[model samples]
Target: LVASGIDTNPWCDEAKKQKKGDNKSRKDVPTDAATAAPSIKSHSDFAEDTATEDSDATKESLASSFGKIVLWMGVVAVLAALHVYMSTPLTRGQVVPPGAWLSYCGLLPFDPECENAYLNVNFEGKVIAYNSNRDVAWEMQGDVCAAQVGSCVRGLELRDNGLIFVGGKRIRSIRVPDKSVSITPWPFAEKPHLKISRK
Candidate 1:
């Protein structure tokens, strides 16, 4: 202890030495541009690197997003294909109603030969009927009459010999007399219009 009640020892000397060392270290490291240039360049480099990383991340995210979109588009296309396949009409093992088959086939264009066969059909039972056509296959049922008249017009008698019936509803073929009973024109057809009356 000293007269001023202060400790005068090696510990006090160490404190003074630490203060001097701190000041000297600060002076040794310059606060000017010359010393700060490296640090400034380093900071700029860090910023540039961060920007590059962000750009890469953005590109990766976009690629991932694009991949997802493509996958969804593929899924949509597959669903559409499935829908078309399921919606198509079937024959034989697949049974379609009389009216639905008619409407569906009517939308498709008919063969010229098929239409031409009926051009000269004027007599009774002369209508050439078909179960299957280029556009549709039908399971026919019930008697067909002209849209104008509910019954057989033009003296067209539906006899057993004139119409070839299998299971009653299905008509295999039609036979017509050489002469028509009436002079009126009748609209009769095969497949869609050659309607057979179910017994």
Candidate 2:
């Protein structure tokens, strides 16, 4: 039977062909699986790395913002402390001399020297005159009583009456013969007036 069926070995030929096809399919299967698995793993690794990097960036930004907030808070606190310090009163018997710190209240005059003019300040360092011409004269010192005896001169005024009225203090009479010279008590007060003297 073997010699007669040499050209017609159907069963044996069929078996060999099946084996070759199986080997080819097996090789292709492993190759495709190997390549595909690596690609998927690479993609997943890239996604994880990106997520970690983004999280780190967000944390750093938050930290930077917190630092700036702390810095500004410190600056504001220092400014507030300085303001409180400057506004507080000095202790007992503090001495501030002439041409020293000044504060005043009341209508004085309108002039360049009068602007920001340092008027007669009480011992408490409160300004009492608006238009004070004294550079240093009658400048009160610390511990001195307010309303204590102090001298003050008014700035220039244009009145033909030959008298300048010191608000609340009485009118100062002036003998404007040549230059203007004002004398206190103005011949117009309820109390004993000061002597009218010419400068």
Candidate 3:
């Protein structure tokens, strides 16, 4: 018998083919560092980065809040100062004659009613009259009160060009011309019932 049919091991042949394929696949995979996927950061490193970002954000927020507070405070301070300046009287120093005389009355220093009325006479004999709102009603240059006069009235004299102020301790009644009225010294009281009557 001739050995025409060689010993054929199909299973062994198939096994050999599979082994070659596995080797080829392994060789195809990238082995170079440049071709590989980027390495992932560790959990600790990621946590640290997040913490740093959060801290920076918090600091920025705090700084912004502080700046806003300071700005508001400055605004409030300015408003307060303005209010005080507007409400306070402008005259300073002695209020008695030879220096200056000041008289005012009303609920508020700026009230248009009797509250804001004021009469001032400076040392130079300059007389100024203001309405309740501190508006200059009239002004003149003269001695308003005679020597030893304590109380006075301001109004238009019969033949005078403008209003005149007269004051004296002995003076009692006053006579005003037709269509003219006099302003008495304000008692510096609240809600005073002031009258402007014809004489």
| TM-scores for every predicted model | 0.30, 0.32, 0.36
In candidate 1, position 187 carries an lDDT of: 25
TM-score, model 3 to reference: 0.36
Which residue window of length 10 is worst by lDDT in model 2?
182-191
Model 3, total clashes: 6
Off by over 4 Å in 3: 6-19, 30-40, 91-199
Candidate 3 on 88-140: residue-level lDDT in tens?
44321212244433445322444456355555655545556666556665554
Candidate 1 residue 21 C-alpha distance from true site, Å:
22
How good is model 1 by TM-score? 0.30
Output the lDDT of residue 134, model 1: 36
Clashes of 2: 5
Q: Which one is best on TM-score?
A: 3
User: Residue 13, candidate 2: how far off, in angstroms?
Assistant: 32
lDDT of 2: 0.41
